[model samples]
Target: MAPKAWTTKEVEAALRGQCEGRHRVAPGLYLRIEAPKPGEGGRASWSFRYQINGRSRIMGLGAVGDVTLAAARRKAEEALLLVRGGADPLTLREQRAREAAAAALAARMPSFREAAQQHIESQQAGWRNEKHAAQWAATLETYAYPHFGDVPVDRIDTDHVRAALNPIWTTKPETASRVRGRIEAVLDSAKVRGWRSGENPARWKGHLALLLPKKAKVQAVEHHAALDWRDLPAFWGALAARGGAAALALRFAILTAARSGEVLGATWAEIDTVQRLWTIPAARMKAGREHRVPLSDAALAVLAEARAAGDGEGDARVFAGRGSGGGLSSMAITMMLRKMKRPGTKKPWTDAAGETVTAHGFRSTFRDWAGEATHHPREVIEQALAHGLKDKAEAAYARGDLLTKRATLMAEWATYCTRPAGAVLPMHKAAAQ
Candidate 1:
């Protein structure tokens, strides 16, 4: 206020307090200052106060003893220029901050790993179980995580994605194809979020197919281990002698020829004793279609016995666990097998190809038995097993349930299963299914 400037000594004298005097001189105007406290360790600074548009302003030059008198004077003069230019330096600082924010946004891009996480979160509700989430995380962590997982998604090209996938595409075609599809979904989500623009780096039909061979042709073929329809009589006996959830689940899998998930997720509500069928809801099915599993007398007997046991621990799941929450996990059946500790069973059993077999492979065992042992057409067996049709005509126009044929197949299958190990012939050959 008084000539808008004061010296270090004058300001300090004004502040006659508990410690030695150290003053502040405002850069270009009146200075009000305080002295150092007893333990104030650093050197003293000078400050000046001014006004622009009715807003008070205070500017600091540098420490009194460190800054030469000439430097201090020069800073004050430059501040005068800034004030006269009619620009508020505070406003300019804010504008610079906004510019920095915009620049950062422009340079930001989603990474392949990041985009995938977003995609997984988006589609999580639609998937049937944690397996979908688990598979995505496993494949990405195993494959894509090492490649473009750290690369910016917008910078990724089809070739970059292909390189990540090509190594396993032929030998592990199904897995590779699934990984590629997951990548495509990630990029599409990135595009939606405005972090990406251009053709999807993982698109297969037009782009990847050009670089890689057709998946069906280049894919490695796998074979399933099946019993000689004649050997099934003995296999069933060995399986029957072993008793536990695994033994029971295996028996169910064989009789139904249904996928492992279908059997594991089976519940009492789906089975109708009067109707002699298990109606799996569409959501639980892999083909995303509702299916009817025709129950034979033996299959119904298993259910009736299970229901009689009255161990509906969780949600009335026909094979639910001891603690109530949901049906057996997809691995529930596999773990059940490992628990049984059967001989001639690999610590982890191998397939016909000598690869590890899975719960699903049991379905193959049934289909194999049905085909190699009997005179049934493959289509009939497929209908009995609910495979997606290869016959486009039947797929397009088939409205009938094929329930009668399925019942016959199930009855014969059950008989094949229940036949004692050394039984010379079918038990009910006279009134056969």
Candidate 2:
């Protein structure tokens, strides 16, 4: 005869009674009750006992409080069916549990934007400064985010990457290139965390390169617009006539032949009035190396003027913005140049090619003058501009910065900038002097 099944009332009695032993509820289901231990309450739960290959096995259904007698019977009946089918019910349950866990993990995978943000946070410590981090975030937000930022990183494909880059590829080739690289980096990071698989869709060399035109092919290399070296003297005269922090900053930048970022970010602490030097920290320089700039008399005068205006002191910005005590806006010098008239004419000062002169272009102007009109060595000129050597052999041996030689070059440049426009010097004559 088949074993008797449990009733609801009998199951409730088993939970409340003082009995402490296993009681059969069905052919394979049983209610287990344990005696109360030291401070713990008595325990009652359901277990399904079955036979497989003439061997007994047990599976936990649930607690009596959670699984009712009727539910326990149904679960046991299912396990018995599986046992008769030559399958181990416990093994199947464990497999189901593992599958559920994997599903849960897949659901928690990050979106493209989330992955990008995580990657940026993880890499911030190695970047040069906060501005680099900010730039990374800004580009992704403006370019990458709108296309597929909310999509799961694992689902991102080449189509999404192409969508983000195609619009800017030819028009803003440089920015598009950066955006593509950033997307590749974010996707690579996602893959590393096992959130995604497959090759990176944003990769350029063998992948996107096949789809899009090369950056150089689509866009001509554009050099910064620079004033002709011959026009610099008259331009300097006009600049000296103006009296403002922006004008002073521009004058100082031109004198030092420094990049606009370096000039605008300069603090009084970086300037040594006695040594006539401006030392830019490695963090601020583009090459990630410390650079020493030899300051000329003209550059020193600009600093003095800034000092008189209450901007020069320890750690204070040499060209401070109004009311913020921070460095002047990056566009301050450019805007100053924009408003200046060409000598006596109403037109703005522009390069010979008719492009508006940019603050960075002054470096090119300085380089041209040094190469064509002065006798300074190429290494000294490059050192003054804080440029990295391209020749590996020369760079390996060129350990010194050529500071003394750079000082002489800068002083000559300053004198040339301040001299009369008509006083043109022959190259040989200037070299002899």
Candidate 3:
């Protein structure tokens, strides 16, 4: 009825019993029948045959040694299903293959840049400084963003990351390394989340180690500016002219060797006027331990003035603003300096190193003065500054606030900071006795 289907029995006899030449009969009629090469190892393999729009179509199956004779027959029969459906099995397979390839490529996958944003979001809480968090994100955004930003996480390789970093790696090694590590961290996160799967092309120890030079080999870089010691008098005088809470806060930062945020965030509750002490909470301390600042008479004087200006309300901040509307931000003190460059102002404060000093640099001045001019113990000076104790015993058992000692040290420090007495006077005769 259907042109009498071809029989495998007759085909076998045709190839094996009839021709008796070198040609090997592969499965499917008029399919691929190749002369076995010596290196082919006498293994039989499957081949396919079908028809499409009255034309012969053929396809290759895997080695017959890998697939049995019965298996090859079954494959050929399945291939025929496509032929019966008015589709060329070979052409259909190719079209389907291309469609699958296109579908895979079109799949939505996270890029390296997106992975970095996710990583930052997941870990923002642990960072100490909010500015540090900004720096962390911004560095990647600026440097690595253009190179690897659009690259799919799975497609990222060692060279792509290295390419982004190599431009700055030699000259600005520290920053470059940080950028590299951040990229690695994001990729690692991707791997853990199953977004990517591969050997980490970014790992520093076993892989990138072989390519890039060690970062630690390079010398550390310095900041843009520093102050000279000889110019303190004029700078101190200029500071005196700003003359308000901002000026006071700057002076306090200098006087205590504390950071700007610490001084601005101060509240009245922290000060015990009767006891002449300021107990900074552990959360506020850079060292994450409580620090008691001993108040000098001058410091107490400043506090009293601040308190008088504040509402008699006990909870009032010694330095309050209208709730983030106009408090002393980090820019506040820096802006005050820039204003000093205004016409009719005398510029002061050049460092021994011959650069303009910054708001934070005053701490260095105070530390230098403490070392050169005062007799306070190094640990006591450090304790007064609320620097965490390096000494094990002091760190463990010295729980009691050493406010009295700090008060005395700060008073002595304040004496050095303020104008010297008009003239040194002799002690009275009774005091001499």
Candidate 4:
């Protein structure tokens, strides 16, 4: 006898009423039911059978309640279509599973913070100093990391870059500019490593340039507060009387026209008493070129005083700090300038602008004196200052540093600064044409 065809009622009853094993719904669809056991209710599930490449395979559609008989039949039709299309249903399922797993793994990848650290470490050797590396990490930590550090590099976008830079763009333009560049560099490196793929969100030109105010327009050029060249003789008189490493260092800086860092980092090895020259290594110089500073009579005297004071042990800093074997703090000379009292008034000796003069500003004082009082050539003055040449062709052809002329100029400068306060000097009279 032919069995009655399966209906919806028959299928539900088979599953709910615990009628044992399996029933075929259609040619390729089936529902399997298990009898109730000791402490658990029975469960039912659906499977679809299809032939791919002449091999029959079974695929689970879903649980019976989750996927009804009608749904299973529809799925069976879909699977059969896939089989006719020459694709294995099980293999297709596995491929989809692998794709999903890959997506999850990628989503769990290391974020911008990790990538930035790795990038900094990789490029640390090429940077100028430990401070340079520290600054790169510090700026990112202060301004950028709080906002987007944990975001996966693959997902960083324009909005993230904007958020990090916008607040400080107007207030701290220089720092903000640097931070933006760093973010761009780290992202570019991440893309090259296959961890990220997209246009860099931190790009300034065209992308961010449109959004933010022009940096040059927003920030005014601020020159360092400088001491007037006129007040220098009086200031020098007061400075010469003060005795200590700081005072001597300040005097040396003025006489040599060297930067405070170069003065502070000076060692006995860098000095030559016989040659009357102070040879600052390229590493210590701002231009990254070795500089020879002519030690004027006064400058040699200051060095002689420093050596006699026992600044340190062998090959130690010529101006050692209170800390053993350490160079003087950058503030040491500035603090000395702050403490000097004006000759008549109890107030501190300040520049013409009434602001305290900076150690760095003394370079401006030297420049003013050279321009207004002396007949030395501009190149000689520039060379004495250890300034890099602005003209490329001029720099290329000008092999000589004018050291011979600089020695004479520096000695004259030392004489002028050491002269009694308010003394008059005959200004150079230009020869009439």
Candidate 5:
């Protein structure tokens, strides 16, 4: 027997009565009213009842306040048609809802490129230099961007990261490793901001490690190319003959055994001519600690030349560039080294391995000379080179910068560096012993 279709007045009357029961409106539709309970008002809503494949199901349309009688009838008719076609309307509705939710979530999440840029900006203040930020951006753009940069951060998976890393993983292991780490960092930042979730696809220790060969296994560790200490005196003489801010900067760097960035970024305020000290601030230092370099007469003379060429007062660049008041370019010394010729020969100065000499190689040269040719203690040499003590016990015990001992050691280094071409100094008997 077919139940009577409910009229608008019957539906309103049933809702007003607040009865706890379902009243049929049509063959597959009902108006449900629930009695008030414990400080809550009565409730009225619309529901559709139907059978598909001999299984009966109920689906809520909406509240009485939202679904009108006519609208409820239209919805029920649609559901009845779906039932007749052997499809469950409830399942289809839920599927559409899930798809809509995913689309909205994707809209809210940033692309990998945008997330990477934001992460880099947030971390820039802590980085030692602008070059570090530049390197991060460059590596990601060159490797990761083409593969998945425009993809939403939440959608970035292992496959996307693997595609970016696999090509250069074996060929350029160092760069590939940095790219992987950077991608991991960006994704981590995204997760922290709630823009993404799940495991980091670029993680190396346990995840990517399983997929790729270890970095060390793929390539041997490569040190900077350095001039042999034996060949330094002649090389020094030739470098001295050249006249430029870069040449002077290189000479100062070699004398102090400082890193290239440290040398290139030097300012007049960091130097003290009276005290013979070049104090590098913690912000500019790699170890993030202030280091005092006891300047040699040669280093000071180079400074004097630089001062004569430009303003030598507070905050001025020690090696002023041709561009207004700025420090010399970081590549200045490297380019100078590449162009420099060995004494009386057209050949460019190179390490024993025949690689071109690098500005940073001077630190290695100084360490070799201090260890193999001088009687200076290891810690003093390391301190002069601004290296942190590897031994925690030794480091904790060491309070002083060993200024007096290092001053003397640097003086001796200065003497060796200024020696005439073809002169050979004997190794320290103590070192030899």
Candidate 6:
């Protein structure tokens, strides 16, 4: 039987017995079982001997334990198949290994700017709006790209991150904070995609927090100068006197007590004239929740005027800009405020601080009025503002929008705004003072 031609059972027995020399398992596959001589352990390894173009070569088929008896034979057969096809198996394996190494090196070579762009491209669709996408690109272009645009993502360190943040850390703390967060996001994406490996250099809580002063410590709380609740009647009167799309939009914003961005981004499709409701989508609202604002009679009239001003063109934007695309520029209302003179003076409509009142300030004014003047529940007032509840339990249970109560409240608010200056009486003792 020619010694049974070296079966798997024979090979295992020989390896355990510490066979001294190589023994053939197949035509070209051989197993070498080593004796525990000197510091060496009892082990066995398989090898494939092949002749390519009359040149003999030996290729390792891994260790006996790592490669089973059946696996070793399979590898030996594959090697022989390659030799028959006029190709060297050893050279092909080396080539594949080299290609893998090249791919790994290439992945690590992308610059910080390149990686940031890729990350933005991958994530922009999921972002709530285009303005956020623009902000992501703008911050990297203005701050990070200037410092380390061409530097490889894997090589970014504490120094690189600090360099980008240091200049604006104190001077422009708000912008700098956003830039730091964005850089961290891009670097995190790089690490997750296997383009880089290391702790994020721009991390905030434990890492960059050590390098920079707390944002609250270095940055002053600059409130947008709000038109006083007392002055709203007069302000509304003056705003009504003006005639333009921006003025109408500003009036609607005040009547609705909505954010400037929300008011500006309003589209015709979002409003239901029959329901007297302006439903801002979750994507447009900062709270990431849909908010239905009860449209007051004054608010509806403002929309009518806006439609007439645009010659009833049927544009999608409620307050369309000068051009064919996009809604009103956020600054348009601010610019109108800048140009408007106070009731009898050459001075602009300034807040108590003597600074120009911003479009956003109306929301603050609304909050103060709703809190002090109205008998509405605190939750209803907060709901009208589209504010998230600070109390977890309250937020969990308070799901109803209280839309009917809100409608009554908003109507009373609009009526109060349209009242003559003399008809507006003080709601609290301090106001009378």
lDDT of 6 by residue, 267-361 (tens): 88888888999999999988888999999998998888877655343437888787654678888898999998888899998888899999999
Q: Indicate the TM-score of model 5.
A: 0.70
Q: Candidate 1 or 4, higher TM-score? A: 4
* C-alpha lDDT values of all predictions: 0.70, 0.89, 0.68, 0.85, 0.89, 0.86
- lDDT for position 382 in model 1: 85
Name the runs in model 5 displaced over 4 angstroms.
1-107, 424-433
* Predicted structure 2, TM vs. truth: 0.71
Worst ten in a row by lDDT for model 5: 424-433
For candidate 4, write residues 1-433 as lDDT tens digits. Answer: 5455467888977776787777787767778888778999888888877776677788988998788778887888887788778888889999999999767755677689988997999999998778889999999999999999999888889999999998999888988899999999999989987888867889888899999998897885656567788888888888888888899888999999888988988999899989999899887788899999888889988988988876544578999776456788888777777777888787876677788878888998999999889888788889988997899988899998888888888888898899888898876532221
Is candidate 3 or 4 superior in lDDT? 4
Cα-based TM-score, every candidate: 0.67, 0.71, 0.60, 0.70, 0.70, 0.71
Q: What is the lDDT of residue 219 in candidate 1?
A: 71
Runs with alpha carbons beyond 4 Å of true place in candidate 4: 1-108, 311-315, 428-433
Q: What are the clashing pairs of model 4? A: none
Question: Candidate 2 at residue 400, lDDT?
Answer: 93
For residue 332, what is the lDDT in candidate 2?
Answer: 77
- lDDT (10s digit) by residue, model 3, range 320-386: 5534323456676776765664225565444566555678777767777666666666666677667
Which tens-of-lDDT digit does each residue in 333-368 have in candidate 5? 778887888766888899989999998888999999
Stretch of 10 with least lDDT, candidate 3? 424-433
Query: Which prediction has more favorable TM-score, 2 or 4?
Result: 2
Q: In angstroms, what RMSD does candidate 1 have relative to the true structure?
A: 12.1
Candidate 3: lDDT of 387? 71
Write model 2 residue lDDT over 205-278, tens digit each, in one string.
Answer: 89999999999988857689999999999999899999877888889899999998998889999999898889
The TM-score between candidate 3 and the true structure equals 0.60
- How does candidate 5 score on lDDT? 0.89
